[model samples]
Target: MAQAPDHAPDHSGEALVIQKVQPFGEGQIVLTTPSLDADGRLEDRHSAYHENRSPPLVWTPVEHVAAYAIVVEDPDAPREHPFVHWLIWNIPGEATSLPEGLPNEASLGLIGGATQGVNGAGKIGWFGPRPPPGHGLHRYHFQIFALAERLTFGPNVPLETLVSALKGDTLAEGLLVATYEAPESQ
Candidate 1:
């Protein structure tokens, strides 16, 4: 029988890299879904539901990170991701990812022991895009942060509470944005 190739193929078309650095602050770093441009401006779609709901996050890697945290949000919706669609933390230091459909409770191994913060609706999990009809595509941002240590946001801390806990302690941050239009609108 023929022996298999010793080295695996390189399927990674374009590897992820640290493009630049930004101060780890509320206004310094930001995340946005596919609906917006690099400038953080809104895009067309005429419905927040088309917002894809998953925001693209971008941030600098911490110099000495013991752990990391991620928070996906949608600020324009008068709500938290409008108000915390997803909250995940305690990621390891070697990790540099927050792929799509992640922190998803339905999907196994996405967030084994990570904390899930409460959303605007008072739920303790992810809440996908449900933007109102004709309400232009709202921006959703998936914010990732490099922390100095592993955190315990408690059993069900809201986004604000978690943010408060992270005060004066962020080391690095990033974001990944994705856009989605509702079926009828699409």
Candidate 2:
């Protein structure tokens, strides 16, 4: 009674080619900040970075994808199971797009060469948007899975063992959702 990790990856869907991006969830790469505050202006909350800063990814060029896995969860964090802030697999299928400070503790170009896993505040790479002040707005989701094979699960492997070894070897999947609010300090 606990199975949501098929991870898709059997091939033969016409060789493969799926594109499902909800504009802001599929591909838009929005970072905001051109001037609209007052909830109408550019709305500045200290925009030096972060806004979807790492939630606009997509992929579909396969030919033996050896590795590529990303899982950023938030599920309206209040603590439970949907809190894994981030977790990267191998990533490197000719790459697509993951620009926005990404796993940036310094540099995470986004590709199979990428590395990181452990967010939820445990800190490893990217932990922005701290919502808790009033706990009103909180919806941070960024998922990009694509793997035919290529993972070792070393170095951390939190997020429930990287979603349980990515189940079936997920072939392709992309998602992005951003929203944060935690201002009520003194």
Point to the candidate with the largest lDDT.
2
Residue 146 CA error for candidate 2 (Å)? 2.3
Any runs in candidate 2 off by more than 4 Å, and if so which? Answer: 1-68, 73-84, 88-116, 120-141, 156-171, 183-186
Local error of candidate 1 at 29, Å?
8.5
Candidate 1 regions with alpha-carbon error over 4 angstroms? 1-61, 78-81, 99-112
Cα RMSD for predicted model 2: 16.8
The lowest-lDDT stretch of 10 consecutive residues in candidate 2 is 9-18
- How much does candidate 2 score in TM-score? 0.28
- Model 1, residue 65: C-alpha shift (Å): 0.9
Q: After superposition, how far is residue 115 of candidate 2 from its true place, in Å?
A: 12
Q: lDDT of model 1 at residue 102?
A: 44
Q: What is the C-alpha local distance difference test score of each model?
A: 0.52, 0.52
How much lDDT does candidate 2 score? Answer: 0.52
Candidate with top TM-score is 1
